[model samples]
Target: MKRLILVTLTLICAAFTLHAQDTTQQIVPGRVNSASNQTRPYVIMISIDGFRYDYAEKYHAENLLRLSGAGVRALAMQPAFPSLTFPNHYSIITGLYPAHHGLVDNTFYDRKRKETYRVGDTVTVPDGSWYGGTPLWVLAEKQKMVSASYFWVGSEAAIQNIRPTYYFKYHEKTSNDQRIQQVVNWLKMPEETRPHLITFYFPEVDHAGHSFGPESEQVRAAVLQVDSAIGKMADAVSKLNLPVSFVIVSDHGMTNVDTQHTLSLPDTSIVKALKVAPGGEKVLLYGNNEEEISTAYKFLKQNENHYTAYLKQETPVRWHYGQEDIYNRIGDIILVAEPGYAFSFSKRAMHVGHHGFDNNLTDMNAIFMAWGPAFKENTRIATFENVNVYPLVARILGLDITQPIDGKLEVLESILK
Candidate 1:
């Protein structure tokens, strides 16, 4: 009897030890529990500023060609309204529209503060006031996953006191090579601590596109240089031999603007009738009396040949434009120039290329490409909006973003192996 009892005790002890070992093995080190227990895939999101779909299609960029050859490609990424950098980039990261995200415009005057907020300016980062929604990096951190960014708008913002695990101060002259090196070094860290989500931004293409038209050789050279840098990044990731995915996207494409098609603000009588000052491509008109507002609206509308005008609440619903919440951020009357024509604040100034047009313009459509683990090869998806990108990224990282997003988890059925 004593021997049988001892044997039973020994077997129970062994079973418990085996169970513990199984549990330990199941717990992936540094892995957070998302909705799905599947191991999170590493993701690198690279933004080539002002990269147009046609640029990649027409240009002889061997490196970018290699990426497209290896992974899934979207013909064009439709950007949200204004089609500017800050709002579009923010939408890509947050999966929300500018109206919902509260970025409203690239440069919006604040009536209460009596100041102008430029999206690129770090000084304008309010005390949790600048950003309207949670960025993906912050959302990832909340789920106990690590994220890093090189330089993205609102990354410096003190909102929620959340900063990327690693970040560099935004510098206009930061070389493409330097940015690539920084990302590679971050990835070289041990698997347990390396960033699960990484973002790298290249601004030279946009700068060149703005300086010279999108079709100019200068922009083409910038695109090739950025493409080469992307190749270096992919090479480094390939060396890791881990199942990682890379995505290359852009904020907005560029359009050529001719001097003959320019409209000067000073030349318009509508400018003299406004209460508040105007800036950038859009004009802001403020009025205390109903008559002033009505007069301003009629003048701008009657001369539709000279301008594309929108009454404060009457802008197109498709663009998600002119919500009451964003009215203060927007002008009482908003104006956009027709294609080939750009609104110029000064007649003396000269800019060959520009964005910030309606979303319908093909030149305003951006680029999107994804390659590597769990992605389909040589596949092209139809048109997708910028907001859809965030959920796709979240799904890749195995994160559950609890907040409602404007974007949906797109049909990546072809990409999944």
Candidate 2:
């Protein structure tokens, strides 16, 4: 049960792996539940990456449908603009959009730091300085409430000098059984060391959506496997008889791209001159020279095929990106691919399924379902933004929001019992 300890989780990072992932549970010593929080209801927030809002009904994910049916089910959960994995997960956990949270995309460039933050980079992934806003686990720990994470965007890092009381560095090799047993073990601990808030993540659905397209049989298989895991986890947790609430969500939805004719800028020289941070459906290009950016934007706009180009400030107002880029992590030039379109570099083969498009698109909507002692049973609610999840979980675990965030508690308060 010492696997209840936590090690390095990045603001964007899991699994048992081949390269020696430290499976040791890192305990943030001297931390115990504050007396006032000792009896606070527990929260298990789960993210099934790329589990679209309609996947439950479309693919008949029985466990999710039944579980959410017994509690609260939302029409949809909107991902923040860009609709990528890391930024939206961080948005859900931090209640801040990618710009405000400083994770503008799964991979983004920071002019101030003169560095690129890529989700796959092990070196920068665990560095807390790259992340902004207080994660829920950080908020809980700040108030002396023990928290744990199976895997979360920032759980590996010492955000505000705090990691969950128990955590695993990002790795996928760890089996579902191992992950489930670890959660059970944590709950069996003495009250002082037990985690009141725990975050769990699954990447299979997203991986399948990316590799085989959202409608493929492979994706259905992935969704079913994740649904089965959720069912097992819920059953095991229920036997504990604790005041536990389960909040299940996804980072974003998936869509099929025009793989046969992927989008690319006509001017290779202009693209080559800028530092590029490319997402499947969008691309951010940065350079110190204003003229070069203008040239690239103009060139792309004039030759636009299945994509649209925008100067940093000219991006859609609803996106709350560009002009709101407080960290200047956004690029000087942005190109967003149209629905059914994706960007390609050097004419490389593109994946069948893609996201990172406008978050407002119906195809980009994710799922949200909450069930537990603290929620209203059989309640059906309208669609809401992923950011609001931060406040919802905070309200459930009785953690205070230390900073102003985009999420408002009222948006999700009605779902509570």
Candidate 3:
């Protein structure tokens, strides 16, 4: 009797382990004989940081404008609330709100890890624990498809113990042309080893926009430079003659920020009671207890003219923020600056241009343009949010997603052929 009971327990444990492994292996991809069909569809998604929707027209980006005219274009692309770079970029890949993906802001305090994640901090940026949602690269890997990334917000991290087949460490010294050439080299690989999906990131536009105002000549020149690079890259891709598509997008837009249009907390007492996460147009404040939370909320709310304050639960429904289990990642009190204004703990000069403002503002809009075999030609459509992009990319890759995602493929289905 004792031996039978032990044997039964051992069988049950083995069965449970097998079930877990089977669940993980469920995302199998159908093998296609690469030799037979030399024209399997491929995708390249590029991100130009701070590329405002109007820049292509205002700056006369001939290359980008032409691509938009030839392919499908959107009036603009709406970024998620707080309109920062890291959050929205991750959101586009994962199809989850920043609140849901656990990248609440460019800079956030993670209570679980007892660390703060800053865009400039090398260690925090690559730590996978801070990321929640599985990025597109990981999804592609699960489906047995090869993917590569020049640079992406979460690509450096290994989410769910998986990373892209090919990705470089985040380095600022790499040139745009060099990055494009590297991707092209990947494309030149044998059909079996070639990447099915590749991502490219450019930060020059955002850098110029922040250093000089969005309307300044510096930004205009930057736009033109990136446009020329895109033109060259497009030519290179065309030479490959693969069934490829290019999806161009921006993480967010930049707006002019004046040093004079700054809001400083009037009540010093609120600071003593609250822990603040600074930077960006919006400021998030946290407290140790409910009493402190209420105190901070009341103080920020009192100055309604300068900014709008809300409890995490009361944040605007449309923003879709703070809807996840990681409530502490967002904090208790949220303060969104008024248009043309920014929030700062100290009254000082701000960068000439800034983002992270309310998503509804016209200046906070991003850009979207796509050209390829999978898209319609000479098409124009109304604006859509960045979250919807994940589903579109998944569909183009012929992958199924069962995770909780905020994106809907139907929103952008009209432009697909």
TM-score, candidate number 1: 0.85
Over 28-80, each residue of candidate 3 has an lDDT whose tens digit, in order, gives 23332244223457899999989998999999999998987999999999999
Q: On a 0 to 100 scale, what is the lDDT of residue 23 in model 2? A: 72
Query: How high is the lDDT of residue 150 in model 3?
Result: 78
Best candidate, lDDT: 2
Candidate 1: what lDDT? 0.70
Tens digits of per-residue lDDT for model 2, 20-106: 367777776788898888899999999999888899998888999999999999999999998988888899999998889998987
Clashes of 3: 0
Model 1 regions lying over 4 Å from their true place:
1-39, 112-114, 125-128, 266-270, 273-280, 324-327, 411-414
RMSD of each: 17.1, 5.7, 11.7
* TM-score leader: 2
Each prediction's TM-score versus the true structure: 0.85, 0.94, 0.89
Q: Report the poorest 10 consecutive residues by lDDT, candidate 1.
A: 1-10
Residue pairs whose backbone atoms clash in candidate 3: none
Model 3, residue 58: C-alpha shift (Å)? 0.4
